[model samples]
Target chain A: MEILLSLFNGILIALEPINLGLAVIGVVVGLFVGAMPGLGSVNGVAILLPFTFVIQSFTGGATSPMIFLAAIYYGAMYGGAISSITLGIPGASTAVATTFDGRPLAMKGMAHVALVAAALASFIGGTVSNVLFTAFAPLLASVALSFGNPEIFALMLLAFATFVGLGGDDIPKTLFSICFGLVLATVGFDIISGEPRLIFFDITGFSHGIRFLVLAIGVYGIGEMIWTINTSRYGSSMSKVDVSWASMIDAMKRFQEAWRGTLIGSLLGFFVGILPAAGATPGSLMSYGVTKMLSKNPKEYGKGAIDGVAAPEAANNSASTGAMLPMMTLGIPGSPTTAVLLAGMVIWGLQPGPLLFTNQPDFVWPLIGSFYVSNLVAVLVNLAFIPVFLWMLRMPFTILAPLIFVLSLVGTYAAYMDMFDVWLMVFVGVGAFFLRILDYPVAPAVLAIVLGPIAEPKLRQSLLLSDGDFSIFFTRPIAGPITVIAIILILLPLFKVIYDKIKGKPAEA
Target chain B: MRRAEIVTAVLLGFFSVYLMWKSGEPPAWDPDVPRFANIGMIDGEGPGSGFWPFWLSAIMLVSCVWIGINWYRKKSPPSVSEEPFLDSYGKRTLFFVGMGLLGFLILIHIIGFYGGILVFMIYYMRFLGRHGWGITSLVSVSLVVFSFFFFDIAMRIVLPKGYLEPLFIPLYDMFL
Candidate 1:
């Protein structure tokens, strides 16, 4: 009953004219960003984070700005399907699975059907996950109140371990990328002793720590722009999309056929998204795989299978909402986009975690309410604006690329009014472009940069509490199980190699 | 690709070593403080300044060596790519775009934020993108004006004005 009243109050807050308008703008902007190649929710959030400062100043509060940012995040999940269905290219990594059947449906001249199905599935998935979050986040935050420094440190280790273990094919490269970020985090000054560790070369701006905002914009924004320019074909044609009222109804009727896949995706995606470092891409892929395994007509799995489209679309959207649980409740971001959101929360003078729920019900509840509103808004806007989004693809890359570059520079500079940050952004962009070409994953590096500073303080605090005993992490019951999980994550690759060798199968990288 | 992997591995190995050595140099020995005490715990108060970096860099060095061994054994994934890293078109595009960005950064230092954006957009849109003069000028001017209203006039956040400092005063007076 209390939860219902809080939710009702949240809806009332979200219905204010300015808050509603910002949510609409956030959803629209998210759609445009997500439809563009090489731009995902992470870049969308990062690029728009500076604008939140402006919004906060206008509104004289953080509530509306937070709502706007979270709405962008929800809308981007729905928007990522645009290119996947129309052009056989995924606008974001979460839409990669959507391309399997989505592209085939387009080839069969049913692009509109696939697009509508995806939007609806995304809405259902996001709504369901938001409900789960509403029920579970407070409970989880209350439980997390007992976590001390040791447990928090152990949790961070578990997050990193998941990235190394399940992130990709190359464990060594991923580990190297993560260590590189940690090294960067150690720059400026040591918080514990106020001593400088790695800033001895005396560069112009070495004393100030490297901002995650600058690095994020550089790597994800400019680095991706460069990669897209290099790899994309200059002028490609897109499939024609046709949607009408009759076709919409027809598409709705088909939803019953794929309801099982949608349900499975929502369940799996929500669960996977709550785990540290597991994100939408993995959730979507796992759901797609499971759907295929359970399908009676497995032979028709990937060849324009509506279930295939429903499964990943639902899973990715649900996973995006599910990622918010840890970010809001535990101050642990499960994905890069959430990391950027966490940074925004910090900038707004709102510390996320248990205290946020207790002290700032006005801010927290309305943001949750905005998610429900934005998911519905996305479905409506996407359905109404499909042709407009398709026309957006016709814009030349030559124009789009330069605009993105300019925005990245301006956004980075706006963070602290520092020209030095602009220069740093370019340097990181150039370096990241090369690393990307070498097949190194950049998400782990970004996550490490955000989590590294937090982990260091907790680790030192735990050691101090234990009187410098190294065994303190393993001695505590909560942290001990988490540490064991981290150890297993580290050793899992080695075990895989040994298992493959013993089975006389060639070992995979 | 194989060659790139080899060079990267070697560079990382040396960089990690340098980091480990540098982490040990700070807070030099005193009679009251034991040698390397800063890298360990400080009288049961917790780990000191050098603790996290020193151990993390050691782990990095080990990972680098492991990468090097994989390279030597010809077992790395990058060892098998026969294609060139970038084709001619890709190389040309990257070079021009990279130079344009570098020029923009240098210009921002001298011309201020809005002024630098104006010049950079004109160059990027007109020269690199090959847009018409009208489109280029319109976009360049509109973006600067919009930024002025958004960041300066309404938000009251003062952007770096460089020589254009005087030009924004009237607008700020009218708005603020």
Candidate 2:
């Protein structure tokens, strides 16, 4: 009853004029960003983060800016399907599984059916995850309120361990990326001792530390754009769709056949998304695989199966919302996009952990309430503006690429008002581009940069209490199991190698 | 591709070692504090500031060495692949894109963000994109104007205008 009353109040606050207006605009902007090839929610959020300050200034609160970004996240999930169904290219990685059956449906000249299914499934998926998140977030946050430094550090360790064990990237490269990001966060002055550290060449810019925004924009904005341009091989042709009312109604009727996949995706995606490393992309792909395996006509899985279209679409949307759970409750970001959001929360002068709920109900409830509003806005805008998004997609990558570069450079400068940071960001972008070519995963690094400052202090504090004894982590009941699990996760690759050797299997990567 | 993998690992290894060394430096104010003195627990002060980053960099160095070993064993994807690190088209794209970005940054130092954006857009749209003057100019000019208003005037961010500062004074006088 209490939860329902709070949710109702949150909804009312979310419906206020300014917040509602921001949601609509944010959803529209997000739709276009998500529909564009090589641009994802992360890219949209990172580039536009600086612009949110304007909204923050006017509102005198964090709720409006957060709603804007969250709406973009919701809109991007819906928009990724647009390019997948229409242009035969996944707009974002979260939409990759959509292309498997979405393109096949388009090729069968049922593009309208695929698009509607995707949009509807995404709507259902998001709604399901929102319900789950609301029910679980307060409970989890209350539980996490008891977490001490050792426990928090252990969770951080587990998060990093998941990246190494289950990230599916090269283990060493993943470790290198994580450690490098953590190290970079140590630049500028040390918070504990007030000592200057890692001030490379003693540049004045190093005094304030390398902001997370600079690294995020460089990696997602510039590096990812360069990667896309180099590797882009998408076909130019698009599937034509009838946007008439009759066709949409017919597509809606066909969407009913997708209920099973939607149900599976909504449940599985939420669970998978709650995990530290397994986010929407893997969630969607896993949902697709599971749905296909259980299908009555398994061979039709990637051959215009409506379930195939629905499963991944729903899963991605569901997973996106699910990814917010840990971020808001425990301060552990479940995905790279959520990591950026976590950083934003810190910047907005709010602590992200369990205390957030107790300390800032106004900020928390409205943001949660905005999630539901943003989902509704995203679906409606997506369905109504399909033709517009398609036309926007045809605007050519050359023009879009330059615009992104301009946004990235200008956004970095605007955020920090530092020319040196701007210069350093470009350098980082170029270096990131090189690292990307070698199959280095940049997401871990981005996540690390955000979590590092939080993790490091907790670790030092924990050790300080234990008189420099490492066993403090192992002795505490809450930290003990978590530390053990993290250790196992970190060593899983080694175990796999040993297992393979014992089984006499030939070496395989 | 195979050769690039080991070379990168070695380079990263050295970089990591340098960071570790850099992390151990004493504070400038108290130069007499021994090196690596701050990388461990103080008697009563608890863990020093350098403790975290220095250890993290050591892990990075170890990770780099592990990457080298993986490369030696041909276990990593890049190490076993026979493809060129950057094909001709890849090389050309990187060169053009990289240089274009560097040029944009260089332009910013002299002309400021708005001016830099205009030149970069024109260069990308006209020369690189092969778009005609009409659309390119229209788009570029429109963007610059929008940025100027949004960033400088309305938001009061005051982006540097470089030599173009004088020209913006009239507009600022009119707006303010």
Q: Estimate each model's TM-score.
A: 0.71, 0.71
What lDDT would each prediction earn against the true structure?
0.76, 0.80
Ignoring the other chain, what TM-score does chain B have in each prediction?
0.87, 0.95
Q: Candidate 1 lDDT, tens digit per residue, A269-329?
A: 7766666666786677667656765678655655688887988899988999888888888
lDDT (10s digit) by residue, model 2, range B90-153: 8898888888999988888888778888999999999988899999999899989988886676
Docking class of 1: acceptable
Which residue runs of candidate 1 sit more than 4 Å off their true CA positions?
Answer: A1-139, A165-167, A233-392, B27-36, B82-91, B154-157, B174-176
* Candidate of highest DockQ: 2
Give the DockQ of candidate 2: 0.54
Q: Runs in model 2 with CA error above 4 Å? A: A1-141, A165-169, A232-375, A382-390, B153-156, B170-176
lDDT of 2 by residue, A161-254 (tens): 6556222447778788988888998899998889999999888888899877678667666775676677762222233446678988998999
lDDT of 1 at A241: 42
